[model samples]
Target: MRQRVVVRHSPVHGRGVFALKALEAGERILEYKGELIAWKVAVRQHRKQGVSGHTWFFGLTDGRVIDGGQRGNSARWLNHSCEANCEAIEIDDRVFIHALAAIAPGEELFLDYQLITDEPADDEIRLGYACRCGAPGCRGTMLAASDS
Candidate 1:
């Protein structure tokens, strides 16, 4: 089968996934693959290793996270966008990327990444999850709105 996507240096961030062919809306593009681990362990690894900026961690509804850094695929390169073209749908313990709208060839894939955190969305926390998607109505941060 022909390739569906490619990983390359991205202007929005470091690396990104780009569609190699036209994709229809609702098409299953790729699965966000990686090793499963608890959020606590991931947090420890992050702090102990001092991993900053870009991360390949995808959170699951079951409280576990997929550490894409361990065994990730091209989907890990999908950057964040306020106006995203794709959405991450979690089924069971696995997550899959689906096109939200028709995507043209060479267009970069993006996920909203409504990252939620227990800490207050203070300036420092917002800066940590700062978004560079450059969408017209960018929210500046990748975090989801708090129920405040």
Candidate 2:
């Protein structure tokens, strides 16, 4: 079967998923796949690896997180955008990426990573998650708006 998405260098960040063909709004694109792990383990792994700033941890409603860096797919390349053309939907413990609006071929897919944080989003923390999406209404941070 032909692939629907491709991972490539992104001006927004390190890598990004791009549409290979025109996708209509509401189209189911890809599943955000990864190894299931506890938050503590994920944190410990991140610290041990000395990784900070951008991460590919997708939190599930069940209190577990998908450590995309462990066994992620092209969907893990999806970047964050304030005016995103796609969105992530959680179903059962898996997350799916769906188009929020019509997308053209070669367009980079984006999700509004509304990442919630455990601590207050002070300037220091906020800067750590700073948004480089350059969306018209970019919120400047990847954390949830409430945190900003």
- TM-scores of all candidate predictions against the true structure: 0.87, 0.84
Residue range with the least summed lDDT across 10 consecutive positions in model 1: 44-53
Please provide, for model 2 over 8-121, each residue's C-alpha lDDT reduced to its tens digit, 9 standing for 90 to 100.
Answer: 998878888999999999999999999999855755565565425457877675657788887888887888888899988999888998999999999999998776655465
TM-score of 1: 0.87
Could you tell me how far off, in angstroms, the CA of residue 1 lies in candidate 2 after the best superposition?
6.9
Segments in model 1 whose C-alpha atoms lie over 4 Å from true places:
47-52, 119-124
Q: After superposition, how far is residue 93 of candidate 2 from its true place, in Å?
A: 0.4
Best by lDDT: 1
Q: Give the Cα error of residue 42 in candidate 2, in Å.
A: 3.8
TM-score of 2: 0.84
| lDDT over C-alpha atoms for residue 43 of model 2 | 58
